[model samples]
Target: MSKSYKKHPYLKESSQHTKYGKKFANRKVRKSEETLQHKDYKKQYCSWEISEYKFYMSEQEVINEFFASRNEEYHWMKKFKTLKEALTWWKKTYLRK
Candidate 1:
């Protein structure tokens, strides 16, 4: 007597099934990794570059530029507690003048 084997329905061969299974397996592996740390490092590096550029400007230059472009309605300029703060605002807001 020959032994008869029962085949599982889920194991049926189909091109679409094989393609979907491969894609699902690849997606699972791709999602299981750290990405935030790299992104944070990139953001920090960008911020550092901006600060370095701002710091490169001389204090006198910042002050001169600030007063040259001071706006009467922008009262926030008075609230700046430090020269650096005022200078930063000035560079961003009024340096074009």
Candidate 2:
């Protein structure tokens, strides 16, 4: 019938997707990567633990006290790559008695 021509016609290809740079965001467009690799290798992966105290002490206060004066509450944290280093710092900072 007359409706057959409007439904499906014998036509050529509509369009072609000839593109490049598909994974642009996942790639790093940098000239030098030698120094970057060395820096990454020398980086320290430290794990920090923050403990909240009941009351703030004289010496054990937040460094930015003036910035947030209303919130007097503070917690101390230490970062160390290994358990031994973390225990050492904890003893020196907390268990000094």
Candidate 3:
């Protein structure tokens, strides 16, 4: 008697990804991992990079960058009660100009 075997769905010899899956993965995967809208918001409001080589940036990243760039010029930003307040002041004082 011969043994009968079944193939596993996930253990295929070749990839099971379809054309649509490949396309979606290629189109969506990015080094920065940020959406277009988020990038725009960060660039315009947070003074983030608007170039093609931009990376993902959080609020903390913004604060750190702010301190690094301004140095002693805007040291008062550290006195803000919240990150939002400091960011708002930074935008108004520097980015808006």
TM-score of each: 0.23, 0.20, 0.24
Worst 10 residues of 1 by lDDT: 46-55
Query: Scored by CA lDDT, what does every candidate get?
Result: 0.46, 0.33, 0.46
User: Which runs of model 1 end up more than 4 angstroms from their true locations?
Assistant: 7-13, 16-18, 34-97
Clashes of each: 0, 0, 0
* Order of candidate numbers by lDDT, starting with the best: 1, 3, 2
User: Where is the poorest 10-residue window by lDDT in model 3?
Assistant: 5-14
Q: Estimate, for each residue in 12-49, the C-alpha lDDT of model 1 and write its tens digit.
A: 23344346544554455456554545444343233222
lDDT of 1: 0.46
**Could you tell me the C-alpha RMSD of candidate 2 in Å?**
28.7
N/CA/C clash count, model 2? 0
What candidate 2 gets wrong by more than 4 Å, as runs, is 1-78
Best of the two (1, 3) by TM-score: 3
RMSD (Å) per prediction: 27.9, 28.7, 22.8
